[model samples]
Target: MRNPSSTGAGRLLRATGHSWRGLVDTWRSEAAFRQELLLGAPLLVLVFALDLAPLSRALLLATLGFVLVVELLNTAIEAVVDRVGADWHALSGKAKDAGSAAVTVSLLVHVAVWICVL
Candidate 1:
């Protein structure tokens, strides 16, 4: 969706506001997101403390970021699906499932990367 503001700075400011609202809404409503944060935040701190090669450390960080990004996208997908209607539809289920699979795949890769790095 196009931002209402015409100027670049205005648009950026508006977008940031929208993003902040999204994060707030998601955090308040989504249990899985909160759970992920509980797990990921400490792992993030642990990553910074560990002595590791730069490349490995970066890979670990990237994987954690990837999982959260995918989770956000999945949440967006689920929200859109619900907004469409309450009725059960095959296509909607497929879209939700696909988004969930993306998160699962990201998590698997995250675990693998951490294992390899350790």
Candidate 2:
């Protein structure tokens, strides 16, 4: 028979893989991901057109990545809120609003970096 410890480890690996795939699916379905990709693609092109130094180009890309990352977290929060219930609840509203605020701040930061760098 297979070792019990190895079997348990395999189950854990599968569970982790499944959870990651679910997150990826959510990212694909979310409109926020589409918006970010649209904006980021053009921003990346502009950065390239500017012919920035290697460090500056990297910083610009990193800032855009931060915006996308925050968007994914916001999507996750909204998904959880909806998953919990459709009915209005103060705490649920606050959680989602807070997540949106994070996205806003990330975008603002990206803008600030672009202004300073370019």
Q: lDDT per prediction?
A: 0.91, 0.88
Writing each residue's lDDT as its tens digit, candidate 2 over 63-117 gives 9999988888898799889999999999999999999999999999999999999
How far does residue 94 in candidate 1 sit from its true spot (Å)? 0.6
Candidate with maximal lDDT? 1
Report clash pairs, candidate 2: none
Per-residue lDDT for 116 in model 2? 93
Q: Which candidate has the top score in TM-score? A: 1
Give the residue spans of candidate 1 off by over 4 A. Answer: 1-4
Q: What is the alpha-carbon lDDT for the whole of candidate 2?
A: 0.88
lDDT of 1 by residue, 34-115 (tens): 8888899999999989998999889989999888888889999999999999999999999999999998999999999999
Q: How far does residue 37 in candidate 2 sit from its true spot (Å)?
A: 0.4
